[model samples]
Target: MKMKKVQEILEAHIWAGEEDLEGEVYAACGCDLMSDVLAFAKEKVLLLTGLVNPQVIRTAEMLDIRAIVFVRGKEPSKEMIEMANHKGMIILSTQEPLYMACGKLYAAGLMCESED
Candidate 1:
């Protein structure tokens, strides 16, 4: 799915990297645990999390996951946004909680890929 579709599906507001909205995401992973994200995230995956921290950006960067949706209306700090901007990542925020956000994306055909 395209990042633009993910934004529309989640009713998300782009906080950064709007220019990259055309980017394609092969899968989506909704998790707040950075360790799990590091372990399971695949290339070009969209990350959905309520954990608003720089570490999330770092984790996404490490995995080359370019788009992130901050669920439950959680917003990242200015510094975090700056960090994401530097990494050329798309930062989005939505009023939907993590579960609903994930479900909406899944319903929109953004399924997660199995590690196997």
Candidate 2:
């Protein structure tokens, strides 16, 4: 799924890296635990999370996640935004609950790529 498409799917607000919303996302991982995201996310993934912290961005950087969708209307911290911006990750916010957000993305064809 393209970042632009994901934004549209989630009806999200882009807070940064709006220029890169056209970037493609081949996989998605929904999680609040940064540790689990780091442990399991594959390449070219979009992270759907409610954990609003700087570490979220840092974890994304390490895992090469290109986008982050904050579920349940969560707003990331300023430090998180700055970190994500510096790393060129698209940051978005949506009012949908986590399960609904994940379901929408999944139903729209964004899936978790198998890691082997």
Candidate 3:
């Protein structure tokens, strides 16, 4: 699914990278543990987490994430948003809890592509 459609599913607000929203994301992984995020996320992934920090954006950059959704109404710092824009990443914020957001995306057919 596209970032716009994911945003609608989560009832989210565009925090940054609004211009860079026209991108595709096939899989989604929602977790607060940075280690798991780094290990599990693959290409064109939509990352949903409550962790708001510069490192989150940095990790997303490292993993080549297509977009980020800050769940549970959490918001990232201005610096983080700027960093995400610089890295050409889309940032989204939603009030839904992490599990709820992930569930919605999965139910909407944004299933993660496995290597099976």
**lDDT (Cα) of model 2:** 0.88
Candidate scoring better on lDDT of 1 and 3? 1
Best by lDDT: 1
The local distance difference test score of model 1 is 0.90
- Residue-by-residue lDDT tens digits, candidate 1, 3-115: 99999888999999999999899888889899999988888789999999999999999888888999999999999999999999999999999999988888888877553
Taking the tens digit of each residue's C-alpha lDDT, what string does model 2 give over 4-113? 99999899999889999888988888899888897888889889999988888888888788799999999988888888888888999999998899889889998875
The residue ranges of model 2 lying beyond 4 angstroms of the native Cα positions read none
- Residue-pair clashes per prediction, in order, are 0, 0, 0
Best by TM-score: 1
lDDT of each: 0.90, 0.88, 0.87
Provide the RMSD of all predictions against the true structure, rounded to 1 decimal: 1.2, 1.4, 1.3
Off by over 4 Å in 1: none
**Which parts of model 3 have CA positions greater than 4 angstroms off?**
113-116
Q: How do all the candidates rank in terms of lDDT, highest first?
A: 1, 2, 3
